[model samples]
Target: MTLIDDRAPASVARTIAGISNGELSGSTCAPELTEGPWAFDLGMPGYGPGASQGDLLPAGSAAQGELPERYRRASGEELSSWIASAKASLGSRVAVMGHFYQRDEVVQYADFVGDSFQLARAARELPDAEAIVFCGVHFMAETADILTGPSQAVILPNLAAGCSMADMADIDSVEECWAELEARFGTSPDESGRVPVTPVTYMNSSAALKAFCGEHGGIVCTSSNASTVLEWAFERGQRVLFFPDQHLGRNTAKAMGVPLSTMPLWNPAKAGGGLSGEALDASRVILWNGFCSVHKRFTVSQISAARAAHPGVRVIVHPECPMEVVDAADSAGSTDYIVKAIAAAPAGSVFAIGTEINLVQRLAADYPQHEIFCLDSVVCPCSTMYRIHPAYLAWVLEELVAGRVVNQISVPSRVAAGARVALERMLAARPDTTMAA
Candidate 1:
């Protein structure tokens, strides 16, 4: 693997295309990734293009229309110039936030770049900006909208940039699960004032899910604060029902000493989550059957390969990975945690990261002093994040400069109110800790 010198002039799209055309020397999980993201927008309704391409999108989910030809046909240089012009025109009226998982091309334009938790804080802090352009995914934009003031518009560059994991737990399915839980374990509080069940939704979920948590006396959690939020839930409820990502819930709860046998998987597609009454009675954490397709790709074999190749190499993974993979790694944490760990390591240290490819590749470029590479060598980015191509960004910014709000993501007032309560609870649960890009 080669270190990223400055930003790789070759964009991810270009690299994948080069590999597909047999003009470049590298590996990619899929050749279909070579196609332009707009191509997917015009065709099937899967996650635009990348890692989660095979994952299913829920019915009635919004689909992006064909991008304007002017933006679509423009070269990278042209798009960059247009984006610059729009940003210069908008000035302080706009604040662009990027997720760590975004490609270098899109991330370069962000005023503030960090993990979803950090970006959520950025959204709330940027009260002066008239608009917050989220260069991440649909859920992140919905989160920014929920966090930002009503006057500040939160715009998603591409309407199809949605998380597959987040889509797995739709409003109807979750509502059904909640009803079953309430029936199985009555809504009454225990003698210690703890309720029978407390709903905890990961930040990756839709605003509707966050609101559902708030309305149900539950809370929202991020990868950075899953343990803290889970602890809060335990204080208020006898057993917690965590949704959207089972690995995160199980890993965080297990780290807190919750036994694996007590954490039962709740399959939304099955009756009563396919669990017997005795199993439900002894449950400590009811995990949802949903996972990040990107993280799920990592494995213990990859960690072993990294160690075998580079003796003393550090293996760090995200909590979203399967529990066995997390257990096999040297350490596990959030994206911010992985970045910080690498930053603090001694010079010349070799590190293997298990997460999305974009952040890992960028980190390799940013810190040439150390050796950093993704555990999975086959280049596969978060499919949803990959959907936000630079063209879409330029289009959105140009639209903003033209006094038009394009792809604005707004949570309904009722849903926002509920989501806000849960998000605020998450904020309060955060530890007194500092994070860096």
Candidate 2:
């Protein structure tokens, strides 16, 4: 599983050779190669900024085809056996955590399966485990690294697994936003004892942005606790600058009765984020120009179609969805909230869920008593999250069993110290008892 090892089987190697020779299309290549840098170099479209290049790949790693093959060619049974054997070999030394949106093959091996925040807490709870193999995306692994003890190593099964939404708000762009805010609204608090703006970042953001929040008097928030976190911000500051996902900020603020006129969009590319000075001055919550691609795909028309086709159907969407879509749905909440809503519904209840397809499909299968389907008919899973294949999971686990740590994600102490402050604030901000969905 070490980066230097040649793990790919002869079949996979030959496939890669074929691809290089222009004899094979990406669709015909091994899934691992097609999903990694190889596909990017071959002019295949990728999901997001870092999908096929940059931070997605390990530092100093060779070409995707030349890199070690952990489980790219393993049969289903072989993968299962390898995973089981690795888990057994590692015993208490390793703990695997999976998000609810993860595929069944990967989730099946998780020691604890839950949302991003829950899984981070799970990592902290497992003090004895030396390694925390996170079967999610890069940001999640970074969060686990921040929360867990220094001795514990957090690993993302696949280096390419990165959140597109999170990548939208980099540290440089956010810092620039902060500078503009400072110039517009002085750094000092007003006579009412509230600062001009409070920086509130969604958990979907990078650790650097989280650190920015911590360094300032800002806080971090999850989908489940966003509203509560925002409420906390307003009390301390005259306005809030929310980042990474504008929809989450907009939806949460809207629910709190914050007027739409006061929530202005901030486009980093444009001067003053494309807002007039008047708009900036009037804004109570400034939303960053970003969104979850998966959630963004959901629309009001999808809701209309669901209602038309399935009479009396309840529509529940994630807050990451566009404001129009969220407004159209019967309810909006986090993935956990959606699960709880379905669990509490009557046996024969029909649900038109607007979120990741994998979660919806799993829910449909889990609750045979009710009818459930994604709002969008087109299969749309989080491309970044879906990057964490079972093959990668098996490879990482097996590597751990061999006492080699690969793809370890460690948040620098300087950054972690600041990020932890914001995360702790969210933890302290008690979430609203009423679930959205």
Q: How many steric overlaps are in each model, in order?
A: 0, 1
Which number leads on lDDT?
A: 1
For model 1, how does the per-residue alpha-carbon lDDT over 329-404 read when each residue is reduced to its tens digit?
9888898898889889889999999999888878887888999989998989888898887888899999998899
| TM-score for candidate 2 | 0.87
Cα error of candidate 2 at position 315, Å:
0.5
State the RMSD for candidate 2.
Answer: 6.4
Against the hidden reference, what TM-scores do the models get?
0.96, 0.87
Candidate 1 shows a clash count of: 0
Stretches of candidate 2 above 4 Å error? 1-45, 48-67
Which 10 successive residues of model 1 have the least lDDT summed?
Answer: 1-10
Q: Give candidate 2's whole-model lDDT.
A: 0.78
Considering only N, C-alpha and C atoms within 3 Å, which residue pairs clash in candidate 2? Answer: 7-69
